[model samples]
Target: MLPSTYLPSVNRLAPPSDPSLEERYGSLHIRLLYHFEHDFYHHTKSLHPGLKDMLALFMNVGFATPYLMDELLAYSAAHKSILGQQTSQLYLSEATRLQTRALTLYNSASPQISKDTCLPMFLFSSLLSQHVIYNVSSNVHNGLGPILDGLTNSTIIHRGLVAIAKASWPMFSEQVQQQLIRSCQRDYMPIPSSADSRGECEVLLSRLNATDMKPESIAVLRSAVENLQDRFDAICTDSSHAMWAAVQDWLVAIPAGYLELLNQRRPEALVVLSHFAVLLYRVAEQWFVGDLGIRLIRLINSHLGPAWEDWLEWPNRATMEQL
Candidate 1:
């Protein structure tokens, strides 16, 4: 095994206070915020003001709704798991129960989804998306199989976000309104690949056979890979947690046809997607992605084989050479 120092400090991120030994988790909410959310904000500096406000509402609102609270707990537990806490499974179990309660409330509570209700719905959905990532990443059998599943969760969450922002942007504070607008622009989000990796991406992209696919499809796929590369660059500059969130956002924002191609296991599509596996492998030490990245690289190789090995040359080396 490689020395732990070679990896990102994601797992070493500790919460602010000790967890409650209380079986009832009476301090669960406070612990969740102080430990997980605070640490995350400190490291990433990129979490939205809207989310920050929702968390505050979860604490102070007299009517601190069930779904909102449940999502908070689920997010906290999942974050704990990612940080390598020994009690991750225990926290995950509690998170699962709370998520179920949150979903039930969501099903029963919504005809109005208006300004008064939209923020909570948006926050709950966003947190649930993160929770799903933690859950899928932690499972032994999950590996590469959950890539699309995680992407699907992110896509649904993004749709909800767009709808909510359209109706409720007026309701948020001016700062939050600006933040939402910025997110809509997507220009300010961190780039995935670093300057050093640009050459690698160019090399990979150049190998694609344009004759085999339509120009439109090629354009879409090329855009997706470039964005992925940009995200890889961001990961190196920012905390892995922050950039991973951006990546999740990227998955949802990518052209819908990207997923369609992935579903078809098109070689060109997989080749581009394989680059993301290399990015994921960078954080393999974190409980979030675990060995899934390594598995994904292998899966890609198996799918493409020696015939297309040249296309995978950089990514295969990336996965193998990691510490």
Candidate 2:
């Protein structure tokens, strides 16, 4: 349990003065800086045994904030002194690698480009990976159904629904496709007890029967259902890596709807979507990496925007002692 007192202050650490560090390190340096400041290193150690490795790999990418780095290094030194030498050496090596690659990639880009191209891909990959980890874990806990219920009411869900509607090809089996149409027709319902029970799918069907669904909405529902089904199928079939891959695909798909909701200035939708993102990220990291789940944790903390710093603060001493 972290203390509540430790708010995530703005990253006050200056970038390395050396222009070479900037050229060589690229966005990876920023990532490392962001993560380290958020105390990912400490959190990774606290995760369940199953999630540690994935967390470590995330950390290895060296995305951290300066404040987080100070805490991480201090925590590591105080509690795991013997591992300090090895950890420091590893951090330095990875940082050096990132810097060199960043410089090379930047130099090759056209002068007209204003931003680092690699940054988007790297960030996307990291976020996608984390989202996958979270989805798998939530599914295992039976949490996704409720989360989806929340999303169904969201404006973003509307956009996603619209996207699905616009697709030219059918994305799901006829039966499933119809079921989704019905589900979105009425007020959303809870998940059924079993395949035979009256589940959300059944509620959807009831809604459709009550009203004529817009052909466009039908198309949108069809697309969303199909996309979801494909992911579900992958999860069911691929025993070795299905979990990771399916979750990644799902996260990648989220921004389409998410951005739409954001554009509409729907705060409730944003809250739900953000929760979905955080939950998915946590579960994904837990399932794939075990104890080292902190990497994604840190990434999420940073990406949640400025407010997360305050959220990451340490608890009072009494509260800490109680834990």
Best by TM-score: 1
Q: Output the worst ten-in-a-row residue range by lDDT, candidate 1.
A: 2-11
lDDT of 2 at 162: 35
Sum up the clashes in candidate 2. Answer: 53
Superposition TM-score, candidate 1 onto the true structure: 0.68
Candidate 2 at residue 100, lDDT?
30
Q: In model 1, where do residues sit more than 4 Å from their true spots?
A: 1-58, 61-63, 82-86, 111-113, 175-197, 214-219, 229-242, 282-295
Residue lDDT tens for model 2, 1-323: 11111111112111232334343334544545455434454655443232344344334433442222322232222222223576655554453333233323323332221132222223222332232232232233333333333233232223322332334115444653454344323222332234434121333333334445455444444343344334444333323234434444454454444444434533323333332343233343343333222232333344455653333332111122222
Each candidate structure's TM-score, on Cα atoms with residue i matched to residue i, is 0.68, 0.30
The residue-by-residue lDDT of candidate 1 on 59-97, one tens digit each, is 443136665765677676666655656876777666666
- The lDDT leader among the candidates is 1
